[model samples]
Target: MARYRFRFVACDEGFLRTFAGSAWRGAFGGALKRVVCAMRLRPCEGCPLAGTCIYPHLFEGRQGADPVRLKSLDRIAVPYVFELDDVVPRSFGAGSEVTVTLTLIGDANRRLARSYP
Candidate 1:
């Protein structure tokens, strides 16, 4: 059996009240709520599809508003990628240097990370 997972990430606790409710405003309703839609993805376990779905987050940035559009969602300032690189393998220093990436998931939750290798 394959294992995929969905995580509940909290960026703004106060705006959550708007996300859980079922309401429609118009012209693509409440902006904050739509921008935070979540999902689970299958991690590649040596699958050929990995190129399109793993490693450096084979899904990161692209237009999610073609098949579906979210109004002003791009304006949402949410950190998407959080990376910690250890120069000394965590044996010394304070902690691994963290690289926080701000990204957008394309339609179908797909897009290769812009960093080449």
Candidate 2:
């Protein structure tokens, strides 16, 4: 198990204020896919590389994967977990920072470490 910490500063306080937990999660995952996805597909359905793409592997798990290794399972476990502090304020001011801790397990650590800085 390995963990990586990241800090993100909001450029627009107004924008940050609009996000609730669920909305923030959706936006965060969308942005992460955009950052990592090579094909830039709007929906990853039927993507040729879904089995190997880091975006899908981390976010969606392996869909329709062969169950030879893990019997009767459609997808494997999501290899990373997100930890967000509960101390967030109602709204952030400009240049406010948030810390997100990502814990990677199994092959996720090695795969991400080599590709991410």
Candidate 3:
């Protein structure tokens, strides 16, 4: 079984679990495809459900992830880092990028999504 490393530049977990599902090889023992990840949301802002959301409980860290969801299978949609533009300094914001790595175990799938440019 091969595990993966994901570097979600300025992106959050929710986006990966939700919208991107239609784009790429989703977490069904998925593969590490090319992605232009970026974190657009902040802990204090962005997510409307944050006020009463249980994301904290679902996720392991303050960033929150669904371990039960992750452990359910041998694979996961791991959105490790969340980078935001507001926090960036000048060129950093424009140059910053998100990187994700996935280690394929079995029955991996992939569908590339068009991002950037």
- Best-matching candidate per lDDT: 2
- List the candidate numbers ranked by TM-score, top first: 2, 3, 1
lDDT of 2 by residue, 18-57 (tens): 2244455576678878887788656777777666566776
- Maximum-TM-score candidate: 2
TM-scores, each model vs. reference: 0.20, 0.71, 0.21
lDDT (0 to 1) per candidate:
0.29, 0.67, 0.32
* Residue 90 lDDT, candidate 1, scale 0-100: 21
Poorly placed runs, candidate 1 (over 4 Å): 1-69, 85-109, 113-117
TM-score of model 2 vs. true structure: 0.71
Poorest 10 consecutive residues by lDDT, candidate 3: 107-116
Q: After superposition, how far is residue 61 of candidate 1 from its true place, in Å?
A: 8.6
Clashes of 1: 0
Name the regions of candidate 2 deviating beyond 4 angstroms. 14-24, 63-71, 114-117
**lDDT, model 1, position 44:** 33
| Preferred candidate (TM-score higher): 1 or 3 | 3
- Rank candidates by lDDT, best first: 2, 3, 1
Query: Model 1 over residues 38-89: C-alpha lDDT tens digits?
Result: 2223333444443333232322332232324445443232224322222212
